[model samples]
Target: MKARNKRLILVGSGVALLVAAVALVLSAFQQNLVFFHTPSEVAAGKAPTGKTFRIGGMVEEGSIAREADGLTVRFAITDTAKIIPVTYRGTLPDLFKEGKGAVVQGRLEGGVFRATEVLAKHDENYMPPEAAHAVEQAQKAAQTVSQ
Candidate 1:
């Protein structure tokens, strides 16, 4: 092939490879992307099923329960307007407590959330932005209903 043709071919191949690399990166990112939802959103059927996601809200008071083996714990996460039952089979964080802000990552199955990981507030004043917004919205909704 002529020198010019060879250069053109090389440039075309490089462009094609770059495009392929970008597409692969995007596909991987999409597959690994996790979404956050509130209890109200989950209850409204807005959460993705059969895929991992995050649910943020306050751990409902009087909803924490432990099994006989002590490895499994069940609790309810609430946005004040709706609640979702979550089951976790691992040690909880020291800061985790009922009525405290939490973000649980897991999948919903059989009307319950099977948590793979649970995140608690880092400090006394810390609350996930999504959870805070959810609580605020729920409160506003409750006030609207009562008035």
Candidate 2:
């Protein structure tokens, strides 16, 4: 083969290998990407079925029910406009309580969120951005009505 032709072929092969490597990296990252959504988004059918994702909202007050085994707790996660029933079988975080912001990572099964992991807000004043926006909207509406 001509030296010039060989060089062109080598460059083409190098480019093809680089493209393949990039595609493989992207595919791996895509599988690891987990989405986070609000309760309202889940209720609106925005959550992916059978796929694990994180749902963030407040643990609805008066909606937590413990099973006979004690380890399994059923509760409602709410974003004011929507509520999603969640079943978790494990010790909850100390911050996990009624009316507290939380993010649960799990999958939905039979209309219930079967949480594999629960992440409560870090501090007393900490709230998810979506939850904070929801609260602000509610306050504005209430103020508008009062005025």
Candidate 3:
């Protein structure tokens, strides 16, 4: 083969290998990419089932029930418009209380979220980052309209 042709082929092969590597990396990272959804979104069928993801909402008051084992707790997460049942088999965070914000990561099974991890709002005024941002934007828009 001509030297120039060989060089072109070599460059093409390198480019193909690089593309393959990037695709592999992306696929691996995609599995770790957990998306956050609200209880309303989940009820609307927007949440991924049989796949791990995060759900954020307020712990519905009077909806928490502890199993006899004590390590298993079942509760309802709500976004005021909708509610989803969630089950967690671990000690909950101190801030995880009724009427507080929380984000649970797990897969939905049999209409209940089987949480592998749970994160409670950090402070008294805490809300999930996405929810807080949305609330902020809405308030700003309302203020603008009222002015």
Candidate 4:
């Protein structure tokens, strides 16, 4: 084979290997990634079924329920468009309260979100961007429904 042909073959193999490496890395990252979703999206079946994800929204008022044990708490997340029930069995953050913005990371099962982690906004005026966006989206949806 000519020298130029040999060089081309080597370069082609390197490019193929690089592409494969990148694809493999991306696949692994995707599996570990927790995507953000709003209650409205979950209600619309846009959220994954079993895969873990982050959901951000306002904690529905008058929806928090504590189990007899006190550790297991259940509440509903709302984006104004829809509500998603969430259950968490752990000490909640001090900021966690009804009618506040929160982000929960967990999986959905049987229409209930089983949260492994929960984060609440710290102050009255402070809210995560994800939570803010979700709230805005939900408000828009609510307006559309009312129209």
Q: Evaluated with lDDT, which candidate comes out highest? A: 1
TM-score per candidate: 0.95, 0.79, 0.78, 0.80
Clashing residue pair totals per candidate (backbone < 3 A)? 0, 0, 0, 0
Error of 1 at 4 (Å): 1.3
Per-residue accuracy of model 1 over 40-82 as CA lDDT, tens digit each? 9999999998999999999999999999988899999999999
- For candidate 2, the lDDT comes to 0.87
Mind giving the per-residue lDDT tens digits that candidate 3 earns over 1-147?
A: 899999999999999999999999999999799998877678779988789998887788999899999899999887666678999999999889999888899999988999999899888988978766534554575578789
Report the Cα lDDT for residue 125, model 4.
87
Candidate 4 lDDT over residue span 1-147, tens digit each: 999999999999999999999999999998899999989889889999889999999999999999999799999998877899999999999999999999999999999999999999988988779878888977886788899
lDDT scores in order: 0.96, 0.87, 0.85, 0.92
Clashing pairs for model 2 are none
Worst 10 residues of 4 by lDDT: 133-142
After TM-score superposition, the amount by which residue 7's alpha carbon in candidate 1 deviates from its true location, in angstroms, is: 0.8
- Residue-wise C-alpha lDDT for candidate 2, range 16-93, written one tens digit per residue: 999999999999999988898777778779989999998887889999899999899999888766789999999999
Can you rank all candidates by TM-score, best first? 1, 4, 2, 3
